[model samples]
Target: MLKVHEIFSSIQGESSHAGWPCSFLRLSGCNLACSWCDTLHAGDSFAGMSVADAAAALAALGLPLVEITGGEPLLAPETPHLVTTLADAGCTVLVETNGSLDISRLDPRAVAVMDVKCPGSGMEGRNDYANLDRLRPRDEVKFVLVDRADYDFAREIAARVWTRQMVHFSPVPGRLDAAELAAWMVADRVRARLSLQLHKYIWSPDARGV
Candidate 1:
């Protein structure tokens, strides 16, 4: 069994799959605390359930996609097994993780939306640089910008380290404005696609389980 916060259905709010209807299996616990973390409660264990139970909950939703997010999903030792179980249930799994963890052990079939923390996050030094080498073209890398400095930092990183096809640049909700980030991306000619937390805008900003 895995520590779990909640399981619900919602639209993909970040990464390349944004706007797609998906079943969310939010696992509990994280190794880092970013300043802009919206799901602080997710890291605090509210319940526990097995992978099969999680898959069954998602199957009941009848969604084609299942997003396993956190408080860093990698904190769960059984994450890879959960991904396989979800896939076997015919759900396209997407794992959203902080880049600090080693995703090398995860199933390559799952779409990884790894978050690369910026200076504003205070945990930027914790980013696992080696994860970049494990990325496939189908996978995505996300950088959350809290200010212009974060944007510049992300741009530099993208130019030097990341050359993935599906790179995403997202402004920290309520910190940096999306329009400003989009303008910066255009002016700098950055290669990453701009990502907006669409669900936040669609629903209450404080809403849980999407």
Candidate 2:
């Protein structure tokens, strides 16, 4: 059984896939609590269900792309099984996880968007730096920048990490302005793509499920 928080259809909001319509499977629980996290709702008690049941619910959505996000999806021991089951059901599974978890155990077919916490996030030290070697080109590494310090830190990591093609940077939802972050990227000549929460601009910033 998987501890699922919610299963709903929404656009991919925070990665290169942003603005694309996708179904989201938000699981419950997390191993780390970052200061700027917006999905506190996902941290509550989860409703358990079998992998088959989860896949069936996803099949009913009829969407090709499915994101397995969470308070931290990798914390769930059943995550790899869930990813495989969803893939078997013809869903393109994407798992969004904080970089602290061991993703080598996850399904290789699933696209992983691993968040590498920056200094401003307070949980920066918890990042599993070795995960960089484990990421495939299909996977993405995301940095949620809160300020200049975070931006500089992310830039430094992006330079050292061999996965430059998979790098992404996005401002914290309400902390930094998008234009400012974009300009910084240009000035620094950062090799990462800049992203914004497209769903927030489309709907209310706080709206649940697109």
Candidate 3:
């Protein structure tokens, strides 16, 4: 069984999957403490669920897409098996992982939306650079930028490993202006998708289940 924070159906908020109808399984606990964490309330366990039960719950939501997110979902030992099970069942699985852990273990059929923490997140040093070599044709890399320095950091990484189709550049809400981010991307000709938190804009930013 894995520690579960919450499970809900919502629009895919971030990444290239944005706006797609998606079910979420947010696991509890994290290995790193980001300064601008939005889901601090999810850090504690809400319940415990087995891998099969969790997969059934997501499938019952009747969405084409499903995400296994965190509080660092990779921290759960059962997650890789869960991914494999879901993929075998013909469900589209998206593993939203903080890039501090080994993502190379996930099934090839599943898409891994890996978050590469920026300097503003205060967890930059924890990034697993080796994961860059592990990215597949279908996987995505994300950078949640907070300031100009963070933008520069993201740009450099994008240049070095800009092979994928979906390099997401998202700004921290109430911190960095989206317009500024758009301008910077345009000015520098940076190749990445500008991802705004769609769920936050659709509902209250503080809302638990989208």
Candidate 4:
């Protein structure tokens, strides 16, 4: 059983899949505490459900895409089975993970959206850089920037470690301006794409369940 927080259908908020209709299974608990984390409530309060039950719930939504996000879904031992179950149910699965944990064990059919923690997030040291080598061509690496330093850090990583996979640079809402982040991306000529949380823009920033 997984510690299930909330399951809902919403627009793909961030990633190469952004703007698509997606069902989200927000699992509970996180090992790292990022300063800018917007889903803190997801970590604690949750209902325990088996992988089959979770898959059935998402299948009922009839969305073709599903994102298994967390408070760090990787923190759960059954996550791999949950992901596999979802994939077997014919959902194009996406798993958003903090890069602190090894992602190699996740089902190959699911696209991995891994985050490389920036210094401003206060969890940079926890990043498992080895995850870079494990990223598949369809996988994505993400960095949430809070300031110029964070952008520079992301740039440096992009220069050294970037592969065929898409890299995403996201501005920390309220801390870094999206326009300023775009300018940095242009001036630096980084290969990454700018990732905005489309759900936040479409609805209220604080709104949950899309």
lDDT for each residue of candidate 4 in 1-210, tens digit (9 for 90 to 100)? 799999999899899999999999999999999999999988699999988899999999999999999899899999999888888878899999999999999989989999999999999999999999889878899999999999999999877556588899999889999999999889878899999999999999999988
Collision count for each candidate, in order? 0, 0, 0, 0
> In candidate 3, which residue ranges exceed 4 Å CA deviation?
none
Those runs of model 4 whose alpha carbons end farther than 4 Å from true positions after fitting are none
Per-residue alpha-carbon lDDT of candidate 2 for residues 104-192, written as tens digits (9 for 90 to 100): 98888889999999989899999999998888768888999999999989999887663445688889877888899999989977788
Residue-wise lDDT of candidate 1 within 1-210, one digit each (tens)? 789888899888888778899999888888998998888987677688887777788899999998999888988888899898888877788999899988887787899888889999999999998988888667788898899999988888777545544888989877899999999889878888998889989999998878
Error of 2 at 100 (Å): 0.3
What are the Cα lDDT values of the candidates? Answer: 0.86, 0.86, 0.91, 0.92
Which residue pairs show collisions in model 4? Answer: none
RMSD of each: 1.2, 1.3, 0.9, 0.8
Q: Return the TM-score for each candidate structure.
A: 0.96, 0.96, 0.98, 0.98
Rank the models by lDDT, top first.
Answer: 4, 3, 2, 1
lDDT, candidate 3, 4-120, per-residue tens: 899999999987889999999999899999989987887986698899898888889898798999899899999999999989988889999989999988999999999899999
Question: Relative to the unseen true structure, what is the C-alpha lDDT of residue 210 in candidate 2, on a scale of 0 to 100?
Answer: 62
lDDT of 2: 0.86
